[model samples]
Target: MVKGALLAMGVLGAGMLPAFGPCLAAGLPDTPLDRARVLLVVQELEITLLTHPSATLALEAWCATHHMADRPVVVARKMTLPPADPVPGRVRADLGASATQPIRHRQVQLVCGTHVLSVADNWYVPDRLTAQMNAALDGTDAAFGHVVAPLHFSRDRLEFARLWSPWPGGGQGAGGMITPPAAIVRQRAVLRDTHGRPFSEVVETYTDQTLAFMPAVDADYAH
Candidate 1:
């Protein structure tokens, strides 16, 4: 009965802290620290997703944890790869190839209901993947990691950065500058096949949409 009630409320899974349920049911992250706290949550979530077997399911689990499992959507917008750009030096080194390598690019926006959780730029080698896998990527909304799961892949995160542009913090001296709506969490990673050859390079940016339901920080709260 209790479990059914929780499920009805859109809170599923074992990790949904009952104590934090109210916290999850609140407004967007407004203050700088509130955004930072939510970033911490999302960073941990991303770390788990990177290593998970099925990244699509991992994303769904994350959405459930944040009370967004009812309607999940990953709108994968295919993009034409230029001869240059987003092909960072690390990606080349990880792939053991130069920028000349044939790679397909796509941008994805993972939305839960009306909120956009993340936007990812994906660059993958079609040569390394099966024809069916490539077809699934072109035709489905499944994540690249899921489409390539047959490779039994592993991931190496190259970078993680916090973007605090319009809002830096209180004592940080804004100099009367206007603050932006929210912050961003950026990550760069390479996905490797079982034999440890990198087949994909992904850069995911978690936008302010992720902050849509984060809790507000208390003014007197000390970090």
Candidate 2:
């Protein structure tokens, strides 16, 4: 129902807001603070997403940097709700699907250790993939990008929406305590193999769990 509610909200873009009393880095002094660590987290996430080709891998880096978890990212095939919107016709056409060709839908949460960093909705052409690739996708919890890596796929971006940006909001908070959203950013793209054939279309919704960690802060960083 929660996913349904999000979908019914017209277009699912980015985030929701909550207080930051519990997210502060341990042993950091903030007496003279003019900014919040959450601000830094947002900026870091933005730049990482912009520069990285694979959000799944980029998030693995983030998890390692933040020490949020000790393991590589994994996909949890836990999203049971049908996508709020039907696969757009344009997506089918992009994958070169004929009227009779079959397209498959998959949705899963990308989890790192304990936190769910993001949820992804994917529509892919089964015929474009190898039998092993399709089987791995259907049976394993492996991230889509990882499973399809053998194809040497590259992302073809369609759009990016930064639903919550600290700079845009001035990073101002009540008493300098910011409340960040559950979702911070979203992206839509297609995956093209080495031959430049589109095989999958994905829509990813990044959650605040991406910001769930104590960033490495130098002693003088806040000064």
Candidate 3:
């Protein structure tokens, strides 16, 4: 789970104070707020890519090529009992049983300029959302299974007035431009197994290019 403080930064509400430039670094001096802006742009692009249909199929094909196929199992048993002792010294044998392995699943989320895009799909099931994301991104096979699960994309929306408010004794000019603060965007995607256990989750915040993955989140797999 992402630190609660970071998560709190993405919440939306009235009377919420604007984040200062210093707060953007979260104590990392070298990581400037400007750098965060670039990361946000990349997140926006990622969201656009994920919404493309062709990209989705390309990702699926990539998974097929890279991942091994699930093996099948067969079972056989034999029992023998000599004449009839009370229960007879019975002999039994079993063969050809494979392990009940877990299935592979994936999820992706994108956050851009106060808008969030979420796509949740599984390798074993058809994914319409993935298809839409791929088409939007113009993605091809290059991004397939290699991208892995729990991918997150994020972007930031600027509030110019907030950036300038502290200047000149913190006074507002008669003609100063000011607008309502834009809400940060958030997207979440969860992938579940047949038993309704979530195998993967992708969560992203738009304002700071933050991505989080919680492998244990609950999911509904009924359908």
Candidate 4:
């Protein structure tokens, strides 16, 4: 399960904390380190949904009912050739669904350098995680406006510093002498809504460790 994978990555936490000061000041929820992790999970769910036959059928039925079968959507994948070949490639899927025989999946082949990649048997995905992902996608879309505020606040509070540097600048001065200075960098959080609006905002400060959140959002109130 995706939740299990997240748990393995240490995303859940002990309890809910109070919302104080600025939204960014509140700190991240005991969740993954950043939005990237969430996005990867979302992508995986989307792939699963797209590949599952049952899920495809459902989406096809919906598309047909809505009369939106002619729309063209694009999907992509990266590919690498065997060591002996040294070629690179990609695969792209163009899909359209409708009320009648909705869900037409196509495969395209790409060749680059000395490599080739192929995509085939376009289908629907119907996993439990896909349903959860759909819900999360919906929630993200509904809360699009408010999400950025907290992310920005968090970045201001968390910072990191580098420990090592070369002394006297250029080429290790005088008998390999080295100097180190305390360098500070801040942690930033980013998120994206369903419409694909990139939210590059900082929300809170964090230690070099894992955090988690319990019931991160109230599903009843999300919509």
Backbone clash numbers for all candidates listed: 0, 2, 15, 29
The parts of candidate 3 lying over 4 Å away from their true place are: 1-183, 192-198, 208-223
Q: Candidate 3: lDDT over CA atoms? A: 0.26
Name the weakest run of 10 consecutive residues (lDDT summed) in model 3. Answer: 87-96
Q: What is the lDDT of candidate 2?
A: 0.68
Residue 10's lDDT in candidate 1: 18
Tens digits of per-residue lDDT for model 2, 1-223: 1334233222434332333224433233332342355566667887887777677877888888777777766555545655544555776776788766788878777888877777787889998999999999888888888888888888888888777655434433454444455667888888899999999988787776776554455333545
lDDT of 1 by residue, 1-223 (tens): 0111111111111111111122231343345655465446556665756656444556666666666546654445443334544444555666677678877766665556666555566768888899999999988877776678789887787766665432344222243322233334566678889998888877665555554444432232344
Query: In angstroms, how far off is 103's CA in candidate 2?
Result: 1.0
lDDT of each: 0.56, 0.68, 0.26, 0.22
Q: Tens digits of per-residue lDDT for model 4 on 175-201? A: 332211111111222222344333222
Against the correct fold, how does model 2 do in TM-score? 0.79
Off by over 4 Å in 4: 1-28, 31-51, 54-72, 85-223
User: In candidate 2, how many Å is residue 96 off?
Assistant: 2.8
lDDT (C-alpha) at residue 166 in model 1 = 27
> Lowest summed lDDT over 10 consecutive residues: which window, candidate 4?
1-10
Instruction: Pick the winner on lDDT between candidates 3 and 4.
Output: 3
User: Candidate 3 lDDT, tens digit per residue, 31-78?
Assistant: 233234333433443454345322333223322332212321111111
